[model samples]
Target: MTASDDEKKMLRASLQSMTGALESVKMSKANTKPRVCLYEVIATARDGLLRRTKLSSDIRKEEGHRRDLNHAVKDANVNVKCKQQLAFNNQDPAQQDAIANDVENAKEEVITKQLEADAQKERVSSLYLERDDFNNALSRMLDATSIVMPFVNLGEIDDDMLQVGITAQSTFMQFCEDWERR
Candidate 1:
């Protein structure tokens, strides 16, 4: 079966409404936008952490391997902090270059990963709603959240934003495990 034209129209209308709401949210705040500007937050957070970690790791690797494993871990932690503070800096958003390509690719990957992450989150959210999966959602959420955000503030963590991030992480993890896909 396929969606009827009415259903298609309704879907488009729903999307438009959400987009409008997003615009409102974006315009209402600046830095805050970076934090709470997501409905599918678990996926959003996974992408953010992935973005922070990947960038940090790449930079550290280029700077030269850490002297010891402990130092490497420390360096990795610091790098994530640095990335959290580092906003999309380059003035011209339109500008493109070799390094830009890497960042662009990373951003793209974040999208793909988040899509996977979101699918996972949706599964957990459904489980939580139905109460069928029992503690499955909670466990999945915790494991996934830990993978991205262990403890310690990367930078500025608002309570609400942090909570959302936690929920999102758990949801994503639950789905990943449930689907039996990496």
Candidate 2:
């Protein structure tokens, strides 16, 4: 019914969309066929990465807007408090009523803005979590592909080769985790 309510609905929709996208990427990783070409795998990973990047950008933008709205809410609260105090100390009944009305209106506006900002924050947080999930899935796919594709291409389907691939994948994943920490 209200603008804030509409904004909350939009935020929920965005979060659902992002979650679905991440789930799709996870499905793709799970269903990857050994016979699939390396190029296609790379392209799929690239697409996931690009989507994650876009989500990150959107989260940043929403964070900025949320911060601005929070500031506005604070200003509005201050204005309402000032008006209320003035009304309380006023001598004229008419002037006091007018100031009280202004304070009430400001309070309503602050509540609406606060609700919008909170919804934006929720959306941003959801996007960040989804982006992280997508990134992790993509990294695992790339790491596995890097280690396994070589042996697969060489037609070396043996226990020794599988062991080597697993070792390489572990080492590569560890290196990546360390690099991220730095």
Question: Which one wins on lDDT?
Answer: 2
Report the C-alpha displacement of residue 21, candidate 1, in angstroms: 80
For all predictions, the C-alpha RMSD in Å is: 29.4, 25.4
- Per-residue lDDT for 19-89 in model 1, tens only? 99998776556435434433345454555456445545554553342223334445455554444334345
lDDT, residue 53, model 1: 55
User: How high is the CA lDDT of each candidate model?
Assistant: 0.51, 0.71
Deviation of model 2 at 58, angstroms? 1.0
**All candidates' TM-scores?**
0.22, 0.61
Best by TM-score: 2
